[model samples]
Target: MTLVFSTCCFSPFPPLHPGRLTVLPQEALVQIGGSIQLNCSLDCPDGTPQWKGLDTNLGNIISTPTYSLLLITNATVAMEGTKFCVGNCQGKSHQGSTNLQVYSLPDTLQLETQPKELVAGQPAHLHCSISKVYPPGSLTLSWYRGDQRLESPDAEEVADDEELFSYDSELEVPGEKVTEGMEFRCEVELLLPPSDRSFHRATAVTVSTKGKSWRSELGILARWVCNFSCQSHFPMSLAILVCQG
Candidate 1:
């Protein structure tokens, strides 16, 4: 007859909580035509989660609680904005969002050749030209020979008021003591402020030496003449040869 007394002995169960999404690399500012990966994770393992892109219907549902959305190929300005992830856990739903920023970079870069190919004991000139750059900054040009930087007498820089810059460098080929058919490289760098997010372009050339000896040629000619004279017997040995003084 005391059934009401049993209700006072039972404890109430706790309410279910919703799932959450955590993203690594919280903020991203990347250049266009680059790649990025957004790692997302859910705290609970109840149901499959889905990812949605802002202003687009590109949605993907994954079985695992943790997933990575990769901009595997290339990124553009159009790819910037908020991305979202929605999931359900313990009969409750949650969502998370992230913002992306995209930037543009320089386009054209080339090396102007002054003796594009060089030999030892020779002088060479190299110049780098950059086109289509924004927010002009200081430019640095360097000459490298097989991973080792070469010293130059003049490191000249020229810039236009409209955000274009160029650098010219003159280098002398090292003597035989340091020559080994090495590779030479010319590099151009655009210096950015505060963060040093510089962009670099480079070109390389091969260095070699010109043949400077006639001894090898004379030896081959002598061998051919001796072989011909031995085969012919028409008084070839009777002819007298004299050397000039």
Candidate 2:
């Protein structure tokens, strides 16, 4: 019995584990006016988390373990870059980052042009074509006369496929209006949700009557040619000649 009395001691301690930080919108390419959200979460039970955008050098730490950083109401090209989130647990630090890409909207947008040079007091049609849009979303089309916006009764929107969206407008120029050398514009806008930013594309054509007579003559000649031409040939091949003429 005396030999068996050896003392046994035990020590109790919790296992150590590493902390983790996560960011959302992991891979994104957004328009200048669009926005995004970065959510930061930590695995550690006892830690304060902070979020920072490395490009802007802006950040904040909150008492709550989880934190969210908003891209705000609108974003610009200057805001493009990597954003970081950090979690500190008892002096131990863990960090994560997400890359952001911002693109510039087109300055002019248009698909088809009838009577390329618009004439006053005449009906004109402009087709707006928006193509190669990333992150498929809803779109809006608008027409402008100089700086003033125009209302169209025959404006129609059509999505040709997943990568293309278009709108056509039949505009009636006021009979008494004189729009010499004035600019007529077409604008296309793409909308994204959870963000205040909109992608924009626009195209402008100069108004002139100098070429109207020539354009009409060309149209008459085109009609005559088409009337006699064989329909068996590819429509695109003939279209190219008409467009070039």
Question: Which stretches in model 2 have alpha-carbon errors above 4 Å?
Answer: 1-20, 24-108, 120-122, 133-137, 153-155, 160-164, 209-245
lDDT (tens digit, per residue) of candidate 1 on 1-245: 65545656566875444466766456655665667776566777555566664444322323465453534236654566777767667777767766665544365456655565565556655565555443344466687878888776544545556434444566655346235476778776766544556777777776554432344565566666666666776344532121110
Which of the numbered candidates is closest to the native, going by highest lDDT?
2
- Relative to the true structure, candidate 2 reaches a TM of 0.43
- Candidate 2 local lDDT, 92-210, one digit each (tens): 88888876665443455555656665676555666665544434345567778788988855446555444333455555455354366777777777665445467677777776767
The segments of candidate 1 whose C-alpha lies over 4 angstroms from its true place after superposition are: 1-11, 15-19, 24-74, 78-112, 128-141, 151-180, 187-203, 213-245
158, model 1: CA deviation in Å? 12
For candidate 1, the TM-score is 0.43
